[model samples]
Target: MTKKRIFLLLFSACFVFLFYRIYYHPETRARENHDRTRIVTDMKGRAFQVADPIRRIALLGGPTGQVAFILGVQDHLCAVTNTLKMSKLVQEMYPAIKALPGPRTTSGNINIEELINSNPDIAIAGDIDGQIVLDKTRIPVAFLEDGMGEGMEDIKREIRFYGTIFQAPDRAEKYVAFLERVMHLIEQRTRDIPVQKRKNVFQGFSPSHLVTLGGDTFMQERIKLSGCENAAETVTTIGKRTGLHSGLAEVSMEQVLEWDPDILVINYGKPADLYKDPQWRNIRAVRNKQIYSQPAGVFIFNRPTAESAVIFPLWLAAIAYPDLFENISINGIVKTFYREIFDFDLTDLQVHDILLGTYEFKMMKGIKNRG
Candidate 1:
């Protein structure tokens, strides 16, 4: 044969061999099978395809990490919001969380380049522009509408969505069952109480004590489920300016005085601030020292996280009507919850910190008052 013909035969054979290795090789086919994408719908009903073996995840918006942690998928997180990264409780339990890539704020103002570098397979956002994420990063965006609806159902829906993504539906159901049990227990204890006897509770947001949740907000459902009436139920308008929470509304000091809540649950700020402030001295919660701070786990319990949805109501009921929940051990429940849901055993000190609220515990620990 001619040398040219021989060379051509060799080149053709090499091309065929490379093609077989690239496309028909068993390892290559196996990789394709392992990395295949599947369609799943987010809580907002937006359908997107995510890789089957999701190795990395980015949680945008505040406190969404609570769901991932509850599902035992915290190890898969490559990025998280600054709020979660700075959480003392989370940092203690999942030390790696502090080193994860995160945005400065939890408002969904993400740094696209930073997120791109983290190389997450999917980005789950609770409050963000989903289209911007999709166009800029080409990463599938799952919009979590977890806290937007009524109380426990909204939380259950969010957990189920994450469960589906992580292929942990059984674990999600386990958490949901716990929530139902807690709610049932609360109902059984509080059902016979007359409206006149139920506590009038006010949910105060952080930074500004005047900013409170109204009936239009999801917190109203939380308050009701706890067997208390919302003090701000009469005020239906949302606040003109955003503060710690969007559902919060600005009420006049006089209005708060008139409502005269029997108990107060503040997300931030010391109860002493209200007690000492002359402006609030006459308020029933302040005068009676009935103010209780919400707990802080992966996130503040006041937010619509799984921990909040499941535990906050019980915590609220326990505090509001100690006589009714006297036999229930909140500390024991908290310990078991951290163990089973997050797979992290809590020291008594850690549980105390969570129950006392993040800011309060930080104060107790001599940590700076960042809140």
Candidate 2:
């Protein structure tokens, strides 16, 4: 047989062997028992080894820094990129981070001298590029993938992974429990909505083009949980295979008019507003006063990663079925989030602007006194 044929046969044999080992073997039973004792996840979302980690800290990206600050372990950060700015949410919670020192990571050229200067025990950035950068620095780098588009459960597992690495599994367990409690309640309430009533929602891309997230995107999952149906989430499977998802489909305005969305919930700020033009005024959503603007808050759209997932669902739900979930408190969730995860207090003022699309934006100013 040719090499391709030979390789295919080997792969088939391995798959069969692995399947047999998983389903029928006595040893598999023993391994599963151990897995149950510890938190574990595999590359394919399978429960596998419980991650055990110990560390010094290095962060390579802005979002990683964002998450660390949210976790109340900003002190654990040994290094980060200098370009980092505090998000409206982070500043709302902790304004003291302006003084921290971080090194920026670039791909084209390596900064050997600067790398030598920041003596970090571990490099905790979100990608293999971080590892490559750390490798040049000759430091032990732990590459944490920035799972911005991952589902709620996946985000939780990564948080748990961080806790595992930091030897703070209890903290991870605490986060998991809090997430589960809120999610369980939301799921139960929305279980009654029939298929037809689910809102046909359309997401906005960064203003350069008409690209938007499909149900495959992370934020779309939030849209569904929040009681709205994504118009485009069903159209593409682009985000799943490749972790780096961007450059959405170029759709025409005419197509959007055909969809006749009940509400136009754009993830981007005023710039992504499709209904801004005179031609769009005739659109049903615009005519019905349903065109809504989403200002960038704690993080950007669909970045339902880690702590964002906590607030994301609530924010989406509130927007989708405000009447059904008017009583549900984002402030209460914020308090629980800070108390349980960050061990801090979030003011109602922070919660107000956060949902109002004014917390953190480049152009618009937010109301400081939310109450």
Candidate 1 per-residue lDDT over residues 1-371, each given as its tens digit: 99999999999999999999677653344335454888888887788787788778888867577788888888999878767776777788888987898753536467877877676778888644455677766677888774433567877887887899888898899888888888899999988889999999987765667777678767778889989998988777454434345555677778888999999888667888778889878889888899988777777665567887777778888898999989999999989888987889999988887887873355224324443
Which residue runs of candidate 2 sit more than 4 Å off their true CA positions?
1-56, 82-84, 105-115, 147-149, 237-250, 267-276, 295-297, 362-371
What value does the lDDT take at residue 116 in candidate 2? 41
TM-score of each candidate structure, all chains considered together = 0.85, 0.73
lDDT of 1 at 197: 93
lDDT of 2 by residue, 81-158 (tens): 543333556555556545544455332223545544544545565555465664565554455656545787777767
Judge candidate 1 at residue 70 and give its lDDT.
Answer: 82
lDDT of each: 0.77, 0.59
* All-Cα superposition RMSD per candidate: 6.6, 14.1
